[model samples]
Target chain A: MALDQSVSRRRLLQLIGGASVAATAVGTLAACGGGGSGSSSSGGTLKVIGVGDQEAGLRKVLDAYKSSHSGFDFNLSFAPADQVQTALRTQLGGGNAPDVHVVYPGNGSAMSMAQLAKAGLLADLSSQSWTQKIPDGFKGAFQSDGKTYIFSPGSSMLGAIYNKKAFATAGVEPPTTWSELLSVCEKLKAKGIVPIALGAQTPWITQLIPYALVPGTVYAKTPDFDDKMLAGQASFAESGWVDAMNKYLELQKKGFFNDNPNGTTYEQATSMVATGKAAMAVQVSAVLSAFRAASQTPDDLSMFPFPATDVAADNWIPAGVVVGIAVSAKSKKSDQAKSFLDYCGQQENLNTWAEAVSCVPLYGDAKVDPALTLFLPALKANKAVPFMDQRWPNAEVQPTHFAVVQELLGGKTTVDAALKKMDEAYRKKA
Target chain B: MPAVLVYAVVVLYPSIAGAGSAFTDWSGIGNAKTFVGIDNFKQLAHDSQALGALRNTLLLTVAIVVVQNGIGLLLALGVHTGIKSRMALRLVFFAPVVVSPVIVSFLWKFVYNPAPDAGLNAALGAVGLGALRQDWLGNPSLALWSVAFTVIWQCAGYSMVIFLAGLEGVPAELHESAMVDGAGTVARFRHITWPLLAPAVTINVMLSTVGGLTLFTQIIAMTNGGPGYATDTLSTVLYKQAFVFGKFGYSTAVALVLAIFVAAVSFLQIGYLRSRETAA
Candidate 1:
């Protein structure tokens, strides 16, 4: 009986020791994590998460803010575009989101401003001076229910980032009409250059060509197409999107695109144009820096609006507000985060961020990237539309568009079928 | 009692509560959930994407189970002999089992690069087999098989290790007795080794079955369920629903169904395999 009691006592002591060790370990981890967790204004290091496209501008502003503010500090990290949808959204869902994070400008994406603002996950920036300065046309990108929730530097132009040397080799210039574009492609192809580098394997890349086309094919003809779609008066299948999809297939059928485009990636496509293996890739001006970085002669690369129609007057461009940052509504450092966003809203700071990202400044006559010069006349003439997905009612339509495009590219689906699928996805609940 | 309480709090509670979300229209964030009475499940039944993913999942699982185990058995038999390089071969075969699935997926992705002058195509060209080269992951018909090959490559080693352990446990006395009875190599393997390895086969098959059913990491790292949903499995569909489509409720329903399906399959497989073991 005595031995049993002694053994029991020893076991009790061991349990106590183990519990203590575990408690200490927990304490240590918590203390380590404390540095990154949202904290009060005085000495807190605000955590910031951003997507790769936003890194150049977001990092510049953050570094500037840190240098100027005596007490301000930040821990900044960037996620690739695909991971932002999964990893960062998971963080947001779990309610452990960073104080500041990247949010796409409009409603279509899962990580867009409208969706997050509706979820009550973004802090309101309605009272900020820059919010007041936002143009009426672009307000939808920054606001939800008449309140601004995101701060974007400016709009990114969607067009072809073309290799100047490749064009020179083919003795061609940037095309202004669909026929001219096709003729130019034929010339480039004859010159032994892959006319276009399409990387449909990258999900986001699949949407760019269609986005570049639809601004003219769909929106230019029906200026209120988004409203008509919202009211159920228009659908993808019965609209000009069929023409755009046909043109996309026409390019493929003519062998204008690199071989096995569905197998290639965004990086591969970028390098193809950069190295003169391909003449151009339909891409956003936000990625011009990436194209330039890929090229040995950065000056060899420039942008031109991707022509969608034979009529030059009807070939409008797509210039949507680039991805921006928002203060998390649940952040403990909401004020600090808001202050940083407010700082980002200043005219000079806005220009700095916009210039870094190769986008047009939101409210200023700031000197824009030279590569974007060809797109200015369209922007000036009010012949530009926000990206089609930006006004989509729900997140489902965009991914549907991505899938159907791949299917079209792989000869697995017809243009009619692809548009039908997109229309079905569009009709789903937000 | 404390350990049980801890398990209840840490594992059981979260799982049960998470399962409850399958019945609602919770968008995965915030407190705005509506109890829609299994609407998600009803919708899932009609979801073409989910159905397609189910078909892909079953195909992947079957391929992994049959091919992975077959290759593993062959590898085990080859290396279990009195060869001078047996240990080296064993180490080489099992090396991939220790690496991260994400890393392996990335490596294989490089090998599957679609360029004619790069990766597998280049190697094929070097061997005068250029005509055999094809887009490994981008082609809709080939993508699912490409992913299956990657999973098998990484996991066949794991099966080999398990079979090797079973081989170690097999007694030399049985083999000696069979040989003394004038049994040839094939006869000895059929009557002695194969019967003795039943438990190992059961274990390998069960583990691979579960692994195949829930395969996620490699697919996400490599394909992201692309090229017109050719490579999508149930796991990717649920993930896309919750995070990508903002339909957490539907995602949870998928997770619940997948969990139930896996459990049912495992129980049936274990029962059959256990009976086989007993008979052996």
Candidate 2:
């Protein structure tokens, strides 16, 4: 009993000693983590966070800003596209948001404008001199309660990017009607070429074809379709979404896509079209450079609107701002970040930024890239509509669309079944 | 006192706060939350995707635990015998565990590609088993199993080292005596070696159960719980709901369910294994 009591006493002392050490260590760490707030360095350094190719483009813009304003300095960080939203959201929630960040223009995407504005995480940019320069089409995208919060440099069009040389080899013209598109596919198939390169392995790629087609199928006649959806008067299943989805499925039925599109990655799909193994791929303008970079001859590639209807006159292109820059409401460097935004708003600066990302300049007077000249006719004729998802109320709906499209491609679900799933997600009270 | 303070500040506080938030409608942004009073849990009960994810989680856990342990024991047994190449072979088997799970998943993704000329398919074709070639990760039916295979491949070596330690602990004299008494290799292994491995088996099963239940990186890297939620484990579902959808409250509720499940299942397994260890 005496021995056991001594052992117990020793163990208790050891535990107490260990605990005190842990406490001291934790306290030291806490002290180190909580440093001085002396200088307000936030005002001196403009921190910007972006993702994907946007990083390289933004870095160039920052360099230009530095040279022009010799005393200005900035910090920039980049993450993978998939991680950017999560990283930014966590930072904002922790009250350490970057001074400037890349946010999607509308509510449908991750890091959407509306949600951030609702959270009061975004600074009101309505008073900024550049706010007035925003086009009518884009003004509604970044506004909440009639107050602007985001400034986008440009917009991107989603369409069928084809190898011009491959088309010439197959003797098939870019189709203006749905049936004509099928006939072109048949011709391309006979010439031993994949008609369309679909990278369904990347879920976002699954959404692009449907988005590219929806303009002509759903919104050409019903420009108020998204409005009806917001008012709870319409659902995806009851609207022209079924038509767009059916057109998407028809390509699968004809065996026009590459074998095992669900297995093909985005890189593979881009390379397939770029190398002329496939005739075309329905993708966004943002990836045009990626495709070009993979091509032996970048000049051989061009884009055309993906037609969803038989009427050539009714065809429309899907277009939307790819990403917008926003100032964090918590930033002490709001003025400095706004200065960067101000610099971004200049016509020359906007043109440089837009061209780097292969985007259509938001300003009408800005010089357009020669490669984007193909989209000019549609834009000038008012046949290009903003991406349908841009008008959606929440982020969840876009991913739901992606999964449904993947299911449709894989022959796992019907158009109606898939559309019903989308409608269910749309009606989810976010 | 310091330990308690640290625990209270870091682990206990966050856990209690997280549990509290599970009952609210916090969207993980700004301080807007309303107490929904178990509504999130009720939604989880009705959420087909969440239920499906739970089912996948259970299935994946079982598959990984059984397959990983079986392969590990085999490798351990092989290395235990006096083979000239045992050391090198043991090193080879254990190598994969040191590689990151993300890289492992990515490497396996290429190997399991469904294309005719892809790694596994080409190997099958070369072996005249072309009919067995499959869309390993793309097919809904095969995707869960495919990801489970990757998980098993990465960790089987870890399990082997544990079983190896247990095997080393078994008395060589006992095996020699049993052989002298006319015991065959099978009989000796069944009666002596198997019973002696109880502690190692217990440790392995518990570790595997916990790891399998909380699997996220492999699923995310390979499938992203995709091909239309065919492989959505609870962790992936929680991540999507919280991070992707911004339904942090609902996601936390799902996370709470997952936590309860992991704890209950792990407790039951450990109890059963411990009882077996005592009996043996």
Residue-level lDDT tens digits of model 1 in A1-430: 2332122212322322221221111111101111222222455799999999878888998999888888888999998898999899999999999999999987988899989988988887776666776665666777777777889988788999999999999999999999999999999999999999998899999999889998889878887888889999999999999999999999999999999999999999999999999999999999998898899999999999999999998998888889999999888888788778888988889989988899877775467788887876676566777788878989899998988898899889999999999999999999
Q: What clash pairs does model 2 have?
A: none
CAPRI-style docking class of model 1 based on DockQ: medium
TM agreement with the true structure for every prediction: 0.94, 0.92
Flag regions of model 2 displaced more than 4 Å: A1-45, B126-130
In terms of docking quality, model 2 is acceptable
Pick out the ten consecutive residues of candidate 1 chain A with the lowest summed lDDT.
Answer: A25-34
Task: Please write out the lDDT profile of model 2 over residues A188-302, one tens digit for every residue.
Answer: 9999999999879787788888887877877777766777788888888987888888888888888999877777788889999999999999987777877888999999988
Q: Listing candidates in order, what is each one's chain A TM-score?
A: 0.90, 0.86
Fnat values, one per model, are: 0.73, 0.45
Give each prediction's DockQ, rounded to 2 decimals: 0.67, 0.46
Interface RMSD of 2: 1.7
